[model samples]
Target: MSCLKQTVNVNKAELMKNYIKKIFAMLGILLFKVQGQIEDRTLPTFATYPKRLKINLPRNIANPQHIYIGDNVKFGPGCFLLALTEYPTSKMRNSEFNKATQKFNPVIKIGDNVTATAYVQISALERITIEDDVMFASNVFVGDHQHGYQSAATPYKYQPIWKINPITIKKGCWIGQNVIVMPGVTIGECSIIGANSLVNKDIPPKCIAVGSPATVIKKWDDQSQIWIKS
Candidate 1:
């Protein structure tokens, strides 16, 4: 009788342990699902511009709320403009272990009467200024910096390093589809960049540039009103 009672008690304990494990597994699954939903359905906050501005932006992800838009600025569908600031100045000076404060300054200053087509990505790491009467076609990426490629003895997280440069586009410029403007590049006034052009160098005013490493193909003589091919 004593042996039977001990056996029953051991079986009951094992069953209880298995039940607790099942409960923990179910709770973990529920927590994971809830966390995923929260991440997947996150929304962005944007500053309110004027109602006269015609825009068709559909991205509700994490974007800055302090965006300034002009009255006649038109944005097509699937346009992403993200402005984020990092590495506080106070933290860098106050903490001895902390790295230098490298703030990510993203400025999108669009002038009046500008048209931005679908799928344009403008990620300004420092400063991105677009002047008046400019047009951006679909799939244009204009970024200010490439993330640091340096190798360190410790993990990358412990050592905070970054590289950033400013990008500027002057007035009356037209950028065609699939154009990429790298860091520290300036597009001079009234210039045109053709489709699928990678702009790594500075382009002068009143000129047309195309190809992977873009070169000046034609320049408009404003006074003479003729195209000069170079």
Candidate 2:
């Protein structure tokens, strides 16, 4: 009788241990599910969301609330998009953008099917609009404002950023690698800017531009259906 009682007690203890292990396993599963949901957390603070916005790595994106993006947009790694609300200056900052309310205003607007590859930077103080199907290669820099250098004694960083002009890149434009689109520039539709081009002025439609200031080297002649050397 003593031996039977000891066996029963041992069996009950083993059952309890198995029950505890099951409970721990269930808790672990629940925790993993919750962690997965957290990983897929998309910030609701965005003003809008495209049906498919694939961002490999969001880097140096300041004030994304004002950045408007269209459908099927993909941002590659090391892409920097900054719509400046407040400058780095202690005294002079946000004079025109949001002086009274200091709010997030729309600045960088990217249209549908736009892709900016690795290390593409878009810094806009006023506005920068990229139309549909615009492709930007690696290391492309587009900005609408430049740092003030009026005061010789003061450092450039300390000075305010003045809006040069709003930049507009029209639809179906391909900006190659190492291209720099400066302030007040407008790139026309279906234009191909060559690599290492510095575009400071307007580029006509269906033209192939290259070199600094982006001179139009070849213009597409729709009449002859051939490219004419400009």
Candidate 3:
């Protein structure tokens, strides 16, 4: 009788351990399903979901449908792409908002083979076009709108008017770290913008520009086949 009781106790212990294992397995599968659903929500917005288009998590993409990305575009963590469809009210227009709004459809079109590092922000109020093979270093900001600060007495944040313009970064451009590409600016093809530069005006093609209000320091002379000082 004693032997029989000991056998029954051992069997009960084994059964309990198996039951706990099964519960944990089910929980893991449930968590995986939930995560998959979250990732799938962003898929419908893409124009074409090409293979190997990697985007790290924790990205802030507002109006993803209005933002079209081409093939082989990789975005690092903390990248924010804002494409606003309507005019933003005062309550919605602020640094925290990263707003982009226009009378027409505001679009952000990024071409193929583009790589944007961490904390790269592209805010399109009217339109912002980035051509193929463009690389943006960390903390690069591209915006196509500026706040109207004509009123001295009014607080800058409360200024109702948003000056909307369009920005275009042409093909084969490399924007260095902490560069701010402002409104109405067109960065010409194959241009290299230096770090900590502010691009307020249009940059000519095949030039190396650097400074607060970036000026062309050197330009490629096609005839000479070399970079000449500007």
Residue-wise C-alpha lDDT for candidate 3, range 1-230, written one tens digit per residue: 99999999999999999999999999999987876566545544654555556566668787777887888888887888888665555445667546355354788999899998889999886899999999999999999987678878756654544768999999999999999999999999999999999999999999999999999999999999999999
Order of quality (TM-score): 2, 3, 1
Reference-based lDDT, each prediction: 0.74, 0.84, 0.85
**lDDT tens per residue, model 2, 15-73:** 99999999999999998777545533643345577767765544677788888989998
TM-scores, one per candidate? 0.66, 0.75, 0.74
C-alpha lDDT of residue 29 in model 1: 100
lDDT of 1 at 24: 100
Candidate 3 regions with alpha-carbon error over 4 angstroms? 1-44, 47-51, 89-104
lDDT of 1 by residue, 108-201 (tens): 6666777888888877556777788899999898877665546665445435435567777889999999999988899999999999999998
Which is the leading candidate under lDDT? 3
Residue 76 local lDDT, model 1 = 77
Least accurate 10 contiguous residues by lDDT in model 1: 57-66
Candidates sorted on lDDT, descending: 3, 2, 1
Provide the lDDT at 157 for model 1: 46
